[model samples]
Target: MTRVISILFWLSLAAVLAFITLPLLVVVAASFSPTATVTFQPFEWTFRWYGDLLSNRWLDPFLTSLKIATVVAATSGVLGLLAAYCIVYERLPGSDVLMSYLLSPLSVPQIVKGVAIVLFLSMIGFQGFLGTPALIAAHVVLALPFVTRMVATSLANFDANLDRAAQILGAGKLQRIRHVLLPMIKPGVLSGVTFAFIISFNNIPLSVFLVRPGDSTLPITVINYLEYSLDPVMAAVNVASMAFILVVIFLFEKIGGFSAQIHGGSK
Candidate 1:
């Protein structure tokens, strides 16, 4: 029975992987196809569609998305670190309640949040913030919970003895936090920041409501283009976006010493 279960687990894992990967493979292939119709034959593949991505039509939205995602990632990282430190490390009164409020956004549907934000903005007569500013704020709200939870988990698993040793050696609270706590939690912080960047970059439901006439995100632009035509350039755009995301993750992993941490944990 155990052997049978093991076989079933492997089969299920393979099926799940194939489900996730097959569509990406199709997109990559379609990006290289010579025409709108996706072709599997390499001889028919061309880089012409990729060349179209250089135009302002695509570049403007890509830049907008990049800017928003970068700002969201940085803001979420810093705010999450502070919130997690206060709630987890300090354990102040009503910490649980504060955490619940911080994570409340996650439980709400993103579309509902988007609608609410729009209504709130209109009511407050600040509709001027409906473009990039709105996008950044909404993304931060969506991402803050994930960042806070990851950092909190890291803090909870932290070795208290290290802080205590630092205290004994005449290190102050700020110094211990800067040297010991921050370094130990760096992995979780980076992971949260990376997640924030990806989600903000690819977000559509929320962005659809917030985007203005001249300022739109890449995902929104891709969707609007799809509404008019079925173009291979869309596939090329997706491929490039995926490549950019991979590069971002690689850079973050290097900065956070993720590989070293993994090796150390294994040992």
Candidate 2:
């Protein structure tokens, strides 16, 4: 029975892996396909789609997504750090309630939130938030829950003695934080920032609702292209996007240990 179950488990795992990886494999294959169309057997290699991507109107959308993601990550990371610090360290009254409220966004369907925001914003004399500062604001809010939870977990696992020791040594709150607290929780901050950036960069539902024609993001741009043509150009775009993410992940690992940073908060 044990041996039979083991084989079954391996088969199940293989199935899951294939299911997840098949689309990515197809996208990469399409990226390198010589022809404009998608195919399974004939292998064709070309960089023309990349060039096309650069020349096409997609450039504007890429830039707009970059701008919005940048702003959302920075803003959300800072806000999350502050909120996490307050809740974790101070453990103030109703901190549990506040944390629940903040994290509730994660529990809700993202599309629902997107629609709700659009409706409310439209009602409040704002017809559209896409391509505007307000859109970034919405992204930041969505990303905040993840960032705060990460930082809070890090804070929770960290030793409190460092802060108390600093206090004993005549260090003020600000000084202690600068010297002790921040350094101890640096791993959490790094993880939070990394996640916040990735989450904001990849978010579709919110971006879809909030982005205007002038401010469409890379994801939306890809969607637009796919809608009109089911070609390898979309595949090329996906491959390029994956490559970009790989480079960023490499940089992240070089600057700070990504594994340690992320797992540090797991406890």
Candidate 3:
């Protein structure tokens, strides 16, 4: 009976993996299809759709999304680190309340948040802030909670003894933070920053309302393009976008050694 149960469990896991991966595999295949219509035949593959990606129509939105996501990641990482330091290390009064307030955005529906931001901005007569500037602010609000939580967890597991030792050795507050605390928490910070970039890059609901007509994001651009046409070029665009994000993540991991940090965090 035990053997039979184990076999079933393995089979179930395989089935789930196939379910999740098959559609992506199809999209990848479709991206290379020569015809406008999707074709799975191996002989029909071509790179023309990928070539289309270089055109201004797609490149503009891709660059815009990249810029926005980059800013969001950098800004959120710094802000999240500060918030975590205050809550965890300082043990500020009402820290729990502050932490909850910081994370409140996560609980609210993203559509509601987007709507609320737009309405508030309008009410304040900041109607001119609708495009890139407002989009960055909204994305920061969406991403900040995740970054704060990640940094807080790292801070919770941090060794205060290291900071104390640094102090005894004549290290000042800034030195201790710079050499000791920052090094120890580097993984969490990188993880949060990566999450911020991915979140901002892939966001649709919030971005839909926030993007200007000429300066739409990649995801929004893809969606708008879909309304008029359904072709293999769309698939190519998605495949290229995913590849770009993967490259970004790979570069980050190489720079920060995030895997090692994650391993240490697990222990």
What's the lDDT for residue 51 in model 1? 97
Q: Supply the global lDDT for candidate 2.
A: 0.79
Error of 3 at 194 (Å): 0.9
lDDT of predicted model 1: 0.91
Instruction: Identify the runs in model 3 with alpha carbons over 4 angstroms from their true place.
Output: 1-9, 40-42, 265-267
Score candidate 1 by TM-score against the native: 0.91
Span of 10 residues, lowest total lDDT, candidate 3: 36-45
lDDT of 2 by residue, 93-119 (tens): 999999998899998787888888888
Better of 2 and 3 by TM-score: 3
lDDT of 3 by residue, 1-267 (tens): 999999999999999999999989988888888766655555655999999999999999999999999999999999999999999999999999999999999999999999999999999999889889999999999999999999999898888888899999999999999999988888888989999999999999898888888988999999998999878899999999999989989988987847967678423
Error of model 2, residue 265, in angstroms:
9.2
Ranking by TM-score: 3, 1, 2
With a 3 Å backbone cut-off (N, CA, C), the pairs that clash in candidate 3 are none
Models 1 onward score TM values of: 0.91, 0.90, 0.94
lDDT per model vs. reference: 0.91, 0.79, 0.91
